[model samples]
Target chain A: MDLRPLKVSEVNNYIKRLLLSDMVLSNISVEGEISNFKHHYSGHMYFNLKDEKGKIKAVMFKGDNEKINFKLDEGMKIVATGYISVYEREGEYQLYVKDIRSSGIGELYRAFEELKNKLEQEGLFSQDKKKQIPFMPRKIGVVTSSTGAAIRDIITIIKRRFPPCNILIYPTLVQGINAPEEICRGLEYLDSRDDIDLIITGRGGGSIEELFAFNDEKLARTISKLKTPIISAVGHETDFTIADFVADLRAPTPSAAAELAVPDVMYLLKELDNKYDELKSIINKKIKAYKLELENLDTKLNLYSPLNQLKDKKIEIDNFLRDLTYVMEKKLNEKKAEILELKGKLELLNPNIAIDKGYGIIIDNRGKLVKSIDSVKLGDEIGIILRDGKVLSRVENIDEGEKIDEFNL
Target chain B: MNLTYEEAILELEKILDELESDDCTLKESIEKFKRGVILYNHCKDLISKAEGEIKILLEDEENTKEETFSMEV
Candidate 1:
């Protein structure tokens, strides 16, 4: 009857003690389908064990889960042995699992785990050993049951995506006892041939026993040995078969396998069109560049031509010729005027021109023109020349007086 | 121009580079143009040509003749 207030952690601790003291609660077993499984990075596994009626939280430390031989998967039927305890921080009770065992249809899961671990150890699933899937596979070889929905789906998808790609369907038993051998044979046959570019082996969703063929040790080994890249698509996306790990690629389903194996023709066509356009455009650009260059060269050649310079020189000569003609004409006009003036002066000196105006000239007997009176003497003979005739005369009387005007004479 | 698709593309790129350079003469550009045309035609031919129809193997035996498969599985 201690009704005093207690902290949340103290209450949680009290419940934890009560649960641990109970003999049955400390050592308990739980069987349910696993849900929300998470193997934390810190090496602790957290999950929920749920049945149709109820569910419980469970955690298994990495140390204990490491001893677990089988792979834990969601929705797996497992019997977990653990003790119930209260986590003080959350104030919630949870199962601290010590170990887990498979139950019901777990035999097949155990076999799958065993083979996966063995093949993984043998390096069959190594990334370096994986072959690259061709981007454009020439021909694809498919091994699946002809009657199953898997083949139908693969064919439909491959055809829808790429029509030109070649597919060689190797219809074989995808299940039953003979399925493993037949699948191996189909794979081998495809591998031995040179025409086969890639291989896809798979089946539709089924039970563990029905899908057991894909988990066969021999089939996984054979898939690993294939030179051609293979894609495994057995069962649903949740089912991970041994062949899925061994194959070069693992598609979630059969339809996905076809999608991975062949490239879409539409996408390839688009890319090819782009490249083709680039080539044409580049060539056209080259042509345009050449044309521009030709025009430039042509212009340069024309500018360099001597005909243009010759024309310029011709105009220059024409100007010089015009100047020379003007100079000659000016000189001739000046000479003509000077000659006219000189003719006037010469006429003034000419006695004939004076006689033409009723003047006379005198010369001595020696035929010299007497310009001064000293050249003449009294009673000396002289000559007078007129425009019409010439006459002899005498200097009859010499007058010393200086006032002889024309009217007086 | 008689080379593979990849080689033809590479050659075409080289020709483009040559055309872009300043020192390439007119005569050299014409020659490169002709070569580029040939390479373009070769690439187009390679791209257009595709494989034949899909087929299914008849049996486990090896043979060239195969039945042309259809969409029906």
Candidate 2:
């Protein structure tokens, strides 16, 4: 017999090392109903799992519990997988859970599957049955809890994305036994309204059981019958509910639902600006082309404009009129000089001037001037006239003399 | 001004096509340009005229009334 008096710490340390080294205790699984469950503020879970035969203390750290998709309740039946170990300070052995799953969740999932298949077979999940979401919904009808993160996220995002979109919230319970019916009523109420353009029904992230309200069969049928388009956003990204399949569209998160419900006003504003720019550019381009055409027509018509030829003809006529006026004036001056010279010669040939210079004239008896001897062969009477007096005489001629003296009269 | 954005845009497109074609005379161009100005103004006005107010519906058995509403949640 070997007997050694050892300290409590030493003994507890030895037991801890021994249990950790054992293969069966190092890796094992335990199934039990949870009691006295305490999820600590530090994110560590402490609980007691018990059955009719035995009981054990259990703990799950924050990191491992975060991987779980559901919450741990007091009466929940769970299957925990991890190693058994002794704590040296407390001198107690406990189960440190690395992985855990609800034992009854399998049944819930089974029901989910059965409903999904039934709906799929009924054509509720068909692509052809879904309604089209409007490009710019004037009003969005929301079916969700009025005081929660889901509604807050949806409102913030929708307002940020599209300010012009009006939201009509139907404040309904998102979970529990009556939540599905309330959701149905909310959806129905919004659908009945004429002003509602689109409907968004959902809640924030939650466990699978909490999201089961969206999986109700009656809710799916109500959604499928609605004329207005619907979008379902339940739980987190991985969660897919029956409402998601039946609705016109499915979003992974509440914020995502807001994004899908309406178009971004900034982007639409840009598109509107683009359309305006397109109109301006198209019309401006057309106007420029027309301007170029006008220029071409102007050049073609330049050949027909008689402005230059008319100007040249006007100058030629002015020159002809000036030359005609000059020639006529020269001819008039020559005529005046010739008339003056003829007047001087006419004045020198006047017989009245000779009479005034003392020249006399004679006439024969028959009132003829007998200036030549042959003309006075038997002249009986003759008349002689002076400048101031006249005398009458008779003449007889017996011999004709050829000798004649020059006389100036 | 009473036309929708789509109709207004369609007519504006027609005006552009007419101006682009060589068949239009000077008189026709002047007329179409005037009409184009009107259509452009209509399209611009439609975007600005989108009633952007937010409202909530309060319903009773007999009547329903609308009130302006805003909330963080």
Candidate 3:
């Protein structure tokens, strides 16, 4: 190596060239506590980042400084991203910060919280403002990166759970500076259509910085104002963004959002089957009850049947006939006895009986019987009767009751 | 019966209610059972006949057109 005397400016210029040539040094990120933070009148930010054993001077121009989301102060931990270069005049190496963000919490996170609070105060996330998701959505609109895992997962889930739902996808950029506008456009496109019943806007899991677009104020407000119900499914389950709060519903993942949007066909089919079974059983019960009622009515009607009443009446008539026959027999017997007694009495008085009892009877020729001699005229002839024979003889005189003994022989 | 799924379900529930009532005549109950069976079949068919279809809404310079959507995955 040839040794040559060099000026301080020449060495500084050479160091600057060396630093610029190095790609890693030109683009670097340094995380440390901010010590000397100053906002100059020229609208530039000057700061020094110091860690436990090292420190570096950092500067952000007004243009880049305006991009920072949080106010920079001393003793705040931050990650300054920029190129490392050597200043010729000062002959010192420093970080030329292009952007500064809070180290753990992140400037994007702060902005998200700020917007979330503001919108919350505005009542954009009120429950009454939320539109109920249709139980059976005919059409669903999806806004996400066309090629990301979010769309694939959503489509697969929706296809598996509920088939007939029409899915309309608005392919959009999900990150970077232009993502918010594209997302808004997608929302607006879907909102204008009357056929879409629901909208799902999301992307796969990513770093907080990668998900910054979802925290955009314009996008959040756009989601709040959409006529159609929106479900926000962004990043992982733990990642909460402004869009999540403003949306009508927040799904932990893209797959979850699809589940919430539609119902399972198998479950509905099972419910229908259960309903059918219940109806059949109920109808059977009704039939059984009606059969029982009919049997009871048959028995009741038989009790009052006309044929049964007629049979009862026939039995009563038979009983009355038997009683009448017994009374008639008794009366006939009594009459026979009285007739026998009269015959006995007539035996003392009748001619035949009197004849049998050694008494005689007389009759007139006209065949008329004379008890007191009033019926007979004592005219031509008379007859005398005995027990077994009769004889004819002439009647000489008529006998009254006192002279009846004269006829006796 | 050409009842939709929801209509069929509603009619089926009504039939059940009628069958449970004490005043329903046997003739009327039987008629309701027949109708309920028809509605059940209608609802089941409606659910079973659904085919999974995906559609994409494409916007061009002038208008939006809907087309069948299919992916390799």
Candidate 4:
């Protein structure tokens, strides 16, 4: 046999080959509680497995971790099966975990529930902080796994219901260790944008363990504080998560969330049309009533006009008084003229005027007039009066008639 | 010949409150609606008349050299 010195790298490579080929040691199993676990960027997990007596250093490569059945956590008792391996640089042996399972309910679930309860008691899930979703959102924001089927279902449902509304999707991790932080960041991004009216956060159905990120307390509080209304559509309807309680609204599925965020365009159009018809009828009736009332007021106004009433009464009384005054004046003038005529006639036929004209009068013994000479000659006694004085005389009838004719000539 | 714009607006508010309360009878609603229509028309007419008067006032001001201050100012 030929013995030769080897380089440091060569010896380490040789030991790595030997470890890969050793089936018996690589497949061995150990059961213990986890301590001081760390996952490296090289896709390997490093930790210690401890029993009541002592602890052993362990390593689980990326491939072996894929085969693990349950999540590994500090203080969790797990049964791990893997190969025995040695790090050449450190000159230390470590158990590489190929398989892992929970010995009981495990510490991971307890830790998850503890954090969730703390957040719940803090009122992070209170409905008062939840915003109301717009009746008809003009823009909708979706936060979900970029490659998941949930996004596809939401898009399809929204398109079918309404075509005009804008839909914006923010890619996010829905599972794994970093999912919670990524989801919170995505929400902050959408909330900063003024155009987004509502947000839908969810994923397709999954087991409770797979959906653990949604139950994160930080993520739940971030959702509750979002200014934009958020609709949680996390697993199936049966699967409730902390996000569901904290979001503004909860939907059974991704499709249901889209429906709640927007109104049906056709339905809205029909409503507008109906309102237009109703408004038209109301205005028409108002106009007709207004016109009729105006006409009624016009009639009343004409009825109560002071000028017309005064004119009617004035004309009737004026004519009546005019005719009365004319009749009274005519009667008064006629009476006065008749009195003047009576006075003139009396003046013209006065007996005193005849006496002033020097006419003589003869009287008998009883003051009677005698005109015939025969009456005086018959016996007697006669009296005569002149203009100046009265005389009593007796004469023959023939002589008296001659003297009266001579005076007349 | 009815109420002014301010008076009509106040009445309209009353009627709207009554209608929203759901306590008014159908007959009462109809009567109120009729009165509301009259008031609304009166308000519209008053507004138009005011606009016309404003136009006339503006024309007169333009023809003259007087300056007037606006209430808003």
**Highest TM-score against the true fold, candidate:** 3
Q: Model 3: DockQ against the native?
A: 0.45
Regions of model 3 farther than 4 Å from truth: A1-105, A302-409, B1-11
For every prediction, compared with the true complex, DockQ reads: 0.25, 0.25, 0.45, 0.02
| Candidate 1 error regions (>4 Å) | A1-103, A207-209, A321-409, B1-51, B57-73
lDDT of each: 0.82, 0.82, 0.84, 0.72
- Give the TM-score comparing model 3 with the true structure, all chains together: 0.59
What digit string (tens of lDDT, one per residue) describes model 1 on residues A86-175? Answer: 988898889999877677656877777888898999999999999998765767899997768998898888877776667888878876
Report the lDDT tens digits of candidate 4 across residue range A34-140: 99998889978989999999999998888667434346789988877778877878766778786675664445578666877887789876767778887656667
Give the winner by TM-score: 2 or 3. Answer: 3
Q: After the best TM-score superposition of candidate 1, give how far the Cα of residue A238 lies from its true spot, in angstroms.
A: 3.7
RMSD of 1: 14.8
lDDT at A207 for candidate 1? Answer: 69
Spell out the clash pairs found in candidate 4: A26-A83
- Which tens-of-lDDT digit does each residue in A1-409 have in candidate 3? 9989999999999999999899899889999999888989998888899999989998889877764544688899888899999877798899999876678865566677788889999998888988887777878999998788999999999888888778888888787656888899999999998989999999999877667889888998899889999999999899988899889999999999999998898899888888889888988887787789899999999889999899999999999999999999999999999999998887676445556676556676777654555655555567766676767886568655576467655
Mark the regions of model 2 whose C-alpha exceeds 4 Å error after superposition: A1-102, A311-409, B1-68
Query: Model 3 chain A, poorest ten-residue lDDT window?
Result: A370-379
In CAPRI terms, model 4 is classed as incorrect
Worst window of 10 by summed lDDT in candidate 2 chain A = A400-409
For all predictions in the order shown, the interface RMSD in Å is 3.5, 3.5, 1.9, 18.8
List model 1 lDDT by residue over B1-73, tens digit each: 3576557767877776766574666677668777777776776675455654666667545564568766553
| Chain B structural similarity as TM-score, candidate 4 | 0.62
